[model samples]
Target: MTEEAQRRLLVELGASLFQRGYSVGSAGNISIRLEDGYLMTPTNSSLGRLEAARISKLDRDWNHVDGDKPTKEVFLHRAFLDARPEAGAVVHLHSTYATAISCFEEAVIPPLTPYFVMRVGRTLPLIPYYRPGNPEMEPAVHAAAKGAKAVLLANHGPVICGATLIDAVNAAEELEEAAKLALLLRGMSPRLLTPPQVDDLLTTFG
Candidate 1:
């Protein structure tokens, strides 16, 4: 996509997430990988009110080359992109359900549905708590991201990688739904998809 197209799409998707409450109060960031660099939401910008022309642009080396300043959490996006070479976009969102689920230390949501499995992958890595926007966590996140496309940051939220911006957003949304299902099913004996079923889904859709 052209830079203009990417910026417009980011504004649209970001607004969609914020309006529906996946993000609120300038609490999320989205970035798209470009052949020359990246297109990202500006720092302190509300996802709901992004200006396409003012979206931040960064060169491959992470320099801010145009538009507004990039998110302070740029390191978070870089970590996932560097670790997952095939990823073309990344999104970090403070969605309520997923953030609530992240508070737990070791709660891995089971594959309660096939869409969740296909979109979110088999394992959601839980990165130990790191203060948000702390570049110190980049190395740790980068290491964990190497093994999973979606990871829940302890007490923070989810950082997801995708083949495109929409893919990342869709996966993040699916994860939120999966977390909601897990919480709703708590204390009940919910039958999760078996290993072979999960493997089949991964093989077919991952």
Candidate 2:
């Protein structure tokens, strides 16, 4: 895709996620891969009102190439690019439901429900909490995201990666829904899918 197209896609996706309450009040970031560099949202910018032209661009080595400075969470973006070569886009959002799950003690997003297991896989590993934009946080997320497209950051949020921008956004949205389901079912003795049932779904939808 052209640079302008990438920027427009970012703006549209950001707005969509914001409108859906996936991230609010400038609390998330999005990025897309490029042959020479990458495009990302600017720091402190509201996803609901981002102007495409103002998005930041960083070259292959991560130096500023165009527009304003990139989001402070560039570390996490770089980590995903380094670890997951096939990830053409990455999205990090403070979606309420997912972050809520992160606050729990064990912090393991168990695949108790079938839909979550089938669409997002068995577990959304929750890495130890790290301050937002902290360099250390990227390494932990990168490690946990191996072989998985989505991960719930402990006491933080969710980071999703995909081969396309839309796919990444879809995964993040699905993650939030799963988290919401988890919260609603907590302490209610919800009937979780059996291993064989979950395996069947995984085989069909995973």
Candidate 3:
């Protein structure tokens, strides 16, 4: 995507997220990997009112290439992009349901539903708790995100990677939906898909 197009997508998605109550103020961050560096939402900037031209750009070596400072979790973003060559965009959101699920001690998001499996694969592993932006979190995310499009940071939020901005957003949304479903059926003796069903779904979608 052109730089201008990338910037506009960030602004659009950022605004949509704030309006939908996904992340308030500047609490979340998003980024797109560019040919040279990356285009990212600036630190401390309100997603609801972000200006496209002022987005941060960071070089491959983590140096600021343009605009203001990048998000503090830049290393977190870098870790995934480094490990997953398919990652073109990354979104980390403190979406309510996902974060709430992340707070649980045994927060394992299973392949409860077919749609979740199709969109995010069969697993969204729970990375052990680490303070936000901690170097420790990066490795944890890397480990959990293997063979998965999304991973939940214990007591933190969800980090989703995709081949495009919209794909990343959609994956993030799916994580939130799965979390909501998990919470709603917390102790209701809900009928989770059987292992065979999960395997079939993964074969078709994974």
- Highest TM-score scorer: 1
lDDT of each: 0.92, 0.83, 0.85
**Weakest 10 consecutive residues of candidate 2 by summed lDDT:** 107-116
RMSD of every prediction: 0.8, 1.8, 1.4
TM-score ranking, high to low = 1, 3, 2
Which residue pairs in candidate 3 have backbone atoms (N, alpha carbon, C) closer than 3 angstroms, thus clashing? none
In the range 147-171, model 3's lDDT, one tens digit per residue, is 6778888888888898898988898
How would you encode candidate 2's per-residue C-alpha lDDT over 158-194 as one tens digit per residue?
8888888987888888788878888888778777778
Q: In lDDT terms, how accurate is model 2?
A: 0.83
Q: Which model is ahead, 1 or 2, in terms of TM-score?
A: 1
Ranking by lDDT: 1, 3, 2
Clashes of each: 0, 0, 0
Q: TM-scores across all candidates?
A: 0.98, 0.91, 0.94
Q: Which stretches of candidate 2 lie over 4 Å from their true place?
A: 112-115
| Clash-forming residue pairs, model 1 | none
What's the distance in Å from true for residue 76, model 1?
0.6
